[model samples]
Target chain A: MKKLMNDPERIVSSFLDGLVAANGTLIQRLEGTDVIVRRSSPPQKVGLVSGGGSGHEPAHAGYVGKGMLDAAVAGEVFTSPGADQFFAAIQAADQGEGVLLLIKNYNGDVMNGEMAQEMAEAEGIKTEMVIINDDVAVNDPDQRRGIAGTVLVQKITGALAETGASLQDAKRIAEKTVSRVRSMSVALTPCTLPAVAQPSFDLAEDEMEVGIGIHGERGMDRREVASSEKTAQLLLESVLKEIPSAAPLALLINGMGSTPLMEQHVFANDVIKQLDRDIQHTYVGDYMTSLDMAGVSLTLLAVDDELSSYLQAPVHTVQWTQC
Target chain B: MKKLMNDPERIVSSFLDGLVAANGTLIQRLEGTDVIVRRSSPPQKVGLVSGGGSGHEPAHAGYVGKGMLDAAVAGEVFTSPGADQFFAAIQAADQGEGVLLLIKNYNGDVMNGEMAQEMAEAEGIKTEMVIINDDVAVNDPDQRRGIAGTVLVQKITGALAETGASLQDAKRIAEKTVSRVRSMSVALTPCTLPAVAQPSFDLAEDEMEVGIGIHGERGMDRREVASSEKTAQLLLESVLKEIPSAAPLALLINGMGSTPLMEQHVFANDVIKQLDRDIQHTYVGDYMTSLDMAGVSLTLLAVDDELSSYLQAPVHTVQWTQC
Candidate 1:
């Protein structure tokens, strides 16, 4: 597992520096921290903040811009950020209005985000938090891990917050989005940490792990590698069965780190063909990723008028843009 | 190699179908061919057309939209499309004005593109062609392979054509861009074709291939894998030495296929630090890729004020957007 990095200890800082260097026009780093905020002047709206581990390159930072997250905190690779860093992000992102934290339902992330929210509230700043646990792969709904569906939550809530919505309204919408979306992934190969040369897990060339987690957690089942159509059917069926309604779907075909766009799009074609209902909006790319893991995830968001409009709304993020 | 595809024979068609399925709002497939054209009604401007082997996702097709390419013809994986397909692309793209073909300087592509231009001219559809040989790694300038720098050529010329430039002017600017840009790549691992079980090329755990082609063609040199900073210096030095002028530069840090964005950005950070000239533009991502190859390429386009404006102009393509 060779990496194009200088020092394993400096991977996160180098990544932040590189992102700002390439996109300084749209985003900037918070002076002495791993926090990235939009370069534009803070708008008088509810600030949206989301963050977690660092290996998912575009997940938390690539989305920091005008129409998405106001600020994103970064942790070390596959590790959660400390409470102080999240607090710093909240302070940087907040305008006159309050702040809303969109947290993925990982244990470390939730704990740190809660601690940061408490710190912000102590300083007389209004704050709210929404936990996203949309991964249907886990049978226990409360224990489900948030995966690619968190991106949809960010986009929809970010659009609402940009419209000067109140913190309560933003939290409500974020919660609704969390409840409405679900994701499931399949991994053909596991990822290795930048500091380590060994893969997180092992799989034979002819096998695949279904319902894999973004952090390289072992999936619920392993099976013989299937064709694109069958893989789509397997993931889509699991995702569809967990959705609460038959509303028009907003589909996201996300590439786990190393899968090519060619494979992602090919799988998306199969998923669209198998679904019977209307797909209001379609997003296909590496929106969220694990570190060089060769796999793909399918996220289905049941959208009505409001969610559909927000999903289609223009965004100026680096990874996921709509014009 | 385990691929997320149904059959090797159907890979190209499936890829095209998947692309159209996801981006139907912006692009559509030509009725009976593999050419992809914009979904919007044709504008009465010079049509810009480009194409090549199909393995490079988002290169020729991901660029077809309002401010980029008008049409893109697709070939099989790493195989050239026939002249007839290029002719169909020209016919579909041409409105009342003529069409300009952007050909990368591979022997098969040049021959096919030239034959297609002749065929279109015979049918009274006036056409012009520009060949891009920007890879400076090859010593013979005429024999140099066109690589990631072709994307910049497409972009600059596409923006010019969208402004209703005459076919002659579009061709002139396309040729100018071809002359101004240069590229070099480093591959840490080689990719495997969908139909074959063997890899394209092999590298020891500690080795890297420098100056590699976009296809699986071997590079000019091989060495022990170095740090991101050292890699950036090596590639930048080669690219800068060949550039003709000391004018501002537009840099593209392109991911070959499977290199993670985290690694790409880290490399971008190093490249920006080492380059001393004014970097007028910076694009970082998998713009043009070799299927599943883990590598990165650097492309530099020496830009003047005129070229910078076109480089920054808004484009609404599937893979790239500026709004």
Candidate 2:
């Protein structure tokens, strides 16, 4: 695959530099930290922090703004941010109100975010955390990995913090959202990192992998290509079964970077037809994406009044804005 | 290319069903109109409406929310929404405050949006428009096609409208933002439409097209693959020379879907190094994308106080919420 870069090793750093240059007013690099924080941070409220591997754009860092995260620690592509970076992000965003860390439930992410939280607590800044394991794809609920549903937690919890909800309350909301959401994904093709210069995995031209992870990890099942309706049904069935919802819910149809909007929309249609509930709200776009991999993921958030209202609230950021 | 769909013809309709199911509270589809509007129609304030083809996710629709657009009209994949759809969007969004149409410079988008504006005017519902022509890669300044910079115009103008700016004032702001913005894109590979079921174009393994349009249109020049830093320089040189600014600017590193965030960031880093002015804000994510095509685009908006403030203003929606 053709790529634009000086060297694979320099790719990430170069991109970070460009990002900093472009959003200098809104964000600044924490000295000695790979974290990016709002330039005017430590607002007079509780601090919120999130981070992970860097490939998921607009997720951890794109979320660092007024109504969302105060700081985002970024790691290399698909690699967890180091604990030191997370600690620095906490330090940068911390106000007297304390800090709350929003972590996805990946082994590396959970461990590193937890370590950073511990370090921040040791420094006398009270820190709390919510581990979001919202993906219902895994067989063991106890080991279910986090996926795109983590974004909903960020949105809800961030809005709560902006409205002066205490850190404890924010943590409560984050945890609540996580518990109420579930996601499943399927991959049509493997993505290649600029540095790696090879597909993450090999698939026959007619094959696809269901329940694939963001980092191109192995999934629950693999099969030949199926119709859009069938694929959508497959994903929805897996997600809905794991997090059965009787009440109104929110649905997110996310493209794994390389999937066309046409395909995503087609999948969304199938999901709606198959889902047997009142979907309160729907987000059909590339919200959480894998880089250049043709695939889609479905996230369903069982919405209560509070989560629904929060989801409807206004926010401002580069990647996503509500009115 | 592998895709998911039972019938290509049913794609748009089915996708709309799922979107409404998920975002029904904030947005509703205008029956038989192919338009999506804010749930609270006859918006309390001046209405903002923008749209084009369906492939560019989040541009025309993901933007419909509390602080931005009141409605968005969608057409078939890569096709402009019809005049009837645009008219329906206007009717749904228009209150006593009038409406403003933010249109890209594409031929079809401009014609159809203009026709709708005329129809609205005939109905005595005040209407205004700002045509965004921001692609610097297209050599002719007077006839440059609109590309991603139109997104900035939508955002800033939408924020202004939400803040109660008059339709005329909103149009002026939108026009100003459009004038101050420039964009250029490059494609490493062509996208395939599910209906067509073929690559948009044949790209050699090592080929790249610089200054490509969003709809898989050919760019100004085709060149062999270059280093990320070199590619960054080539793109920035054109944008900077065309836009010509010594002041800080808001930069967007947009993906045309298939390119991974790793590559986008690497390109962004190179862009920053080549920039001669301060970086005011940066959006490094897939704000607007072309289906599943593997490519990236760069957008620069020269920011003034008003534009920057508006850009930072709050918005609420399902796809994008910055808290």
Candidate 3:
């Protein structure tokens, strides 16, 4: 595969240099640290921080802004950020108020964010953490992996923090959102990592893998490609059956990476049809995307009035903006 | 080539049904029309409308909500919505105030949206239109093709409309945003249409195309695959050379459907590094994605104080929310 780098090993560092250069007014990087913080963070607002592997653009870092996360630590592609990096993010984002660490359910993410939280607490900062495990495609519900639903948790909890909600309140909201959300994905094709220059997995021309996790993790079943309608039905059914909520909901039809907006919208149309209840709102796009993999995921947040209102609150970020 | 559908022709309708089902409470469709509008749009607000081919997801439709677009008309995959569909969207979204149509500069989109505006005006509803031709990559500066920068036009204009800006005022803002914005894209691989089940263009394993447009449109040049850093440099250099602007800019590092977020972020870092001036904000992700095609685009919006403040304002939509 042809690529655009002088050295494969330095791609990540070089990319960071470019980001700092281009967005210096809004974002600042801590020297010798992978953490990026908003340049306009207020002095006393409780800080919200998040990070993970680097492949998900407009994610861990893109979300760092005024009303969302205060800082994001980025690791190399598909790898967890170091604990020290997470520590740096916490320090940069911390205001006089407390800080909240929003960790996804991936083992590396959980461990790294947790370790950072511990380190921050040791340094006399009041640090709280929430692990978002919202994916329903896993074999065991208790061990369900995190997927796109983490975005919702971050948005809701981030909105709370922006509104000066206490750290405990933000944690409560984050935990609640995570509990009420469920996500499942299907991959039409595997993506190639720039470093590897090969597909993560082999997919037959006529086949697809359903219930996939974000990192190209295999799901429970593999099958021949179905029509967009059938695929949407399958995904929606999985989410509805697992979420255990009978109230109004918010649906997210997210692209893993390479799926076009056309396919995602088509799939979203199908998923919406299968839903039997009134949906309070819906988000159909590549919100929590995988790297250039061709796939889509369905995320349902069974929301109450509070969550619904919070979901509608305004936020400002690089990729998403809402009032 | 396996796909899920009872019949290929029914794919669009079926998907629409599902979307309505999933967002019945937050949005509603014009009967017998492919237009989706927010459920709570008051009759007094000036409606902001945008639409185009279907491949761009979470775009015209996902943006329908408070502080964004009032309605989105969808066409078939990569095809412009029909005149009737655009007309329906206008009628459904129109309030007592006039409606503003933000049309991309594609031939079909402009023609169809124009027809819709005329029809709405004939029905005694005031309507205005602005054509977005922000892409600088196509080499025809005067007749430059509209590309991803259309999204920025939709956003700034939508914010104006939501804040009760007059239809003329919103049109002016939309036009100014388009005038000040520039975009360039590169495709690593051609995207396959679902119906065709093959790539739109043939790209060698080690080849890439620069200055590509959204709909498989030809680019300025095709070259062998380079490293991510070089690719970023090539794209950025082209954009900067074409449209020189001062510091404090809004940058969009967008993904073509199939490129992974890792690659997108990697490229974003490179572009950021090359930029010498202040960047007010940066948007990195798949904002205006092509179908499952592996590529990325860079968009620059020169940020004036008004544009920057407007960009910083809160917005809420299915795909994006900013507080």
Output the number of the lDDT-best candidate: 1
TM-score of chain B of 3: 0.94
lDDT of model number 3: 0.77
Name the lDDT of candidate 1. Answer: 0.91
Candidate 1 ranges beyond 4 A from true positions: none
DockQ head-to-head 1 vs 2, winner: 1
Candidate 1 per-residue lDDT, tens place, A136-202, comes to: 8899988999899999999999988888899999999999999899999999999999999899999
Candidate 1 chain A worst ten-residue window by lDDT: A38-47
The per-model DockQ list reads 0.86, 0.48, 0.42
Candidate achieving higher DockQ, 2 or 3: 2
DockQ-based class of model 1: high
Better of 1 and 2 by lDDT: 1
Expressed as tens digits, the lDDT of each residue in A1-323 for candidate 3 is 54445576666666566565545666677789777788886668889998888666657776777678899888887799989998888888787688999988788988888888899999888888888888778868668888889888888888788888888888899989988988888888876666787888888988999987777777889998887778878888878886765688888878776676656666777666667776778876657766667778888898899998888887766555664
Selected candidate, larger lDDT, 1 vs 3: 1
